[model samples]
Target: MDIPVRAHIERLLDAHASDGLSEAVEQAFRAVPRHLFIPPVALACRDDGPQIIDRDADPDAWWDAVYSRASIVTQLDDGATDIRAGSGDYTCSSSAPSTVADLLQRLELAPGHRVLEIGTGTGWTAALLSHLVGAANVTSVEVDPVLGAQAASNLAASGHAPYLVVGDGALGCPERAPYDRVHVTCGIRRVPYAWIEQSRPGAVIVLPYCPGFGTDHALRLVVTPDGMAYGRFPGFASYMTMRAQRPQRDQPARTDADKHHLTTRVDPRTIGHAPAGADLAIAALTGLDSLGQADQDEDGPRYRLWVSDPAVPRSWAVAVWRPGQDEYQIYQVGDRPVWEEVVAAYFRWVGWGEPGRDRFGMTVHADGQEVWLDTPDQVIGSEARSAC
Candidate 1:
């Protein structure tokens, strides 16, 4: 192994001790070289946004970024825009070293275990999986053809050739069925029934479950003999939504006359800045998604909270709060009472002793998914609805 690459792996291990990077996973990272998967010109990950790193312009800087703990953005706007431009919706990336290790640790992969990888973005993850399990036991699927071709090339260059399929990853590769483990890279709102049906009885599936609420969660599920998968959120994660599961929400443009103004004693920030457990309960109870935006103008700092039902195009509500105000004003204009629904969910969560995210779990079945608390039988909502 190269000294510089070894140094990077050591640094990642030291920094991410709390991430629970197992010794086997650390060895996999040591075996697979990170630089081989990244492009010459791409965006380096940042807290605010990604920045460009061009190998031709600055080899030292590019090399530094390639080995850093940060993720490198490989494609933007689904590769329609050049990566050098450095400004577009992030569509593809070589995931950060810490994120890779964290998810792989949750996977609990063993030697010779059959694995199915969803969203083979840069193929780095697939290559690592091939190293952990034999290349013959690994099957990776990518939704984009161009990315799929490039991933195939990257895997070959790295001296590992796993089964790569260019198709919708939402529909897991059924040709190679009964996998022992399923690893998903993209964030998904709905747990596809195809995955539950394709895996073995005791197979484990790990993915980032973005419920379109306050925060997203990293989910780990175990398949049962009855064709259902049950799991709990391990922690928080943010990732690009699966192409087929992207939310197409509509916030209707409205005039003052169209809006119905109401006032509430509950602070808008309470619901806007709620914890992950409350977020999950609210989404399951109401079947709605929400976002909070904070800004400062001449009138000082203000918070704007928007809630909507993605299924109902014209259904939405906004709650506005300004400093030094005892009560906030809510302007709602839609068929569904989104604000009311949120308030009800918030109180329900508070009544449940304010449970944390770990206390909540999800069960995915053929018709729909259900969110439960503590035990699988204690379901939160009466109706099963997929989180939007």
Candidate 2:
């Protein structure tokens, strides 16, 4: 084992003992050089974690990005649009060690399992799988040409050549069907028909179900001969949604300047178990009281959340747009009191037992897109609609 890398793996194993994920960590360490898998010369080792070896920030000081315990983001916004500076909504990353460990533990890949990894961000995960199941049985798909080329080079240099393809992962590479294990590195709003059709019966597929949960969570599913599997979210995770599969959250504001409304901040304390804290708020409002969808407005890079609750006479905003921008406006008529109603969710959670974020359960139906929260009974679904 690589001495320096092994030390880091040992620490990680010690940190997260539940998963017993050291084997996978060691595999990542020994099989691939920490340097090559990231942007050339943009990585730095840090005591707490991996430091950003951002290439665009300083071209002259480009350093290898592969650092101990660091997950380098190879593609952001699925590499569709450039943010110029500051990483925005990390879309594709060489997933961090802790996250990788969690997924591996949940996935539990055995030897000789043919694995197809969708949304190969940096090819490191595939390389680790190569160490376990051998390169011939591993197939990885990457959407970005730039990242894919870099990943190909990294894999080639690492001496593990899996079938790496640069194309839309939404359509799982059908050329190699009947994979025993299908791992999706990217977050997806929709579980594509192509993936189910291609996998073998009883195949274990792991992917981040995106957009549904306020945050993405890993969905560990089983494949039947007919391409159907029932699985709940393994845990909360954040991954870049697949480029082709990114959900269209184009919720246009309610352009009723003449209209008025009532709104409130879903108490942060009540961020109990539900796909995401935000989703939990939405679920409670829709179920308990009469409410429709929520709306957030972006003004020159800042987002202002706008909500309307017919139950209340007044409205307010608790700020869900962007965390940093200084634009938190909380308002409610003394009588309407939206904040009080919002806090009512917290009390409800307390009454039920304060379940943390993980306890929240989700069941993806046969369609794969529709999700029910807090068991199938708490049905909270998302659809493409104008921001309202």
Q: Which prediction has the highest lDDT against the true structure?
A: 1
- Model 1 lDDT per residue over 129-158, tens place: 999998999999999999999999999999
Summed backbone clashes in each candidate are 0, 15
Which residue pairs does candidate 1 place in steric collision?
Answer: none
Q: Rate the local accuracy (lDDT) of all candidates.
A: 0.88, 0.59
TM-score of 2: 0.69
Candidate 1 stretches greater than 4 Å from native: 249-258, 382-388
Give the TM-scores of the predictions, in the order they appear.
Answer: 0.93, 0.69
Off by over 4 Å in 2: 1-19, 22-28, 41-51, 54-66, 75-89, 247-368, 373-388
Model 2 scores a C-alpha lDDT of 0.59
Q: 268-297, model 2: which lDDT tens digit per residue?
A: 323322335444444334321222223455
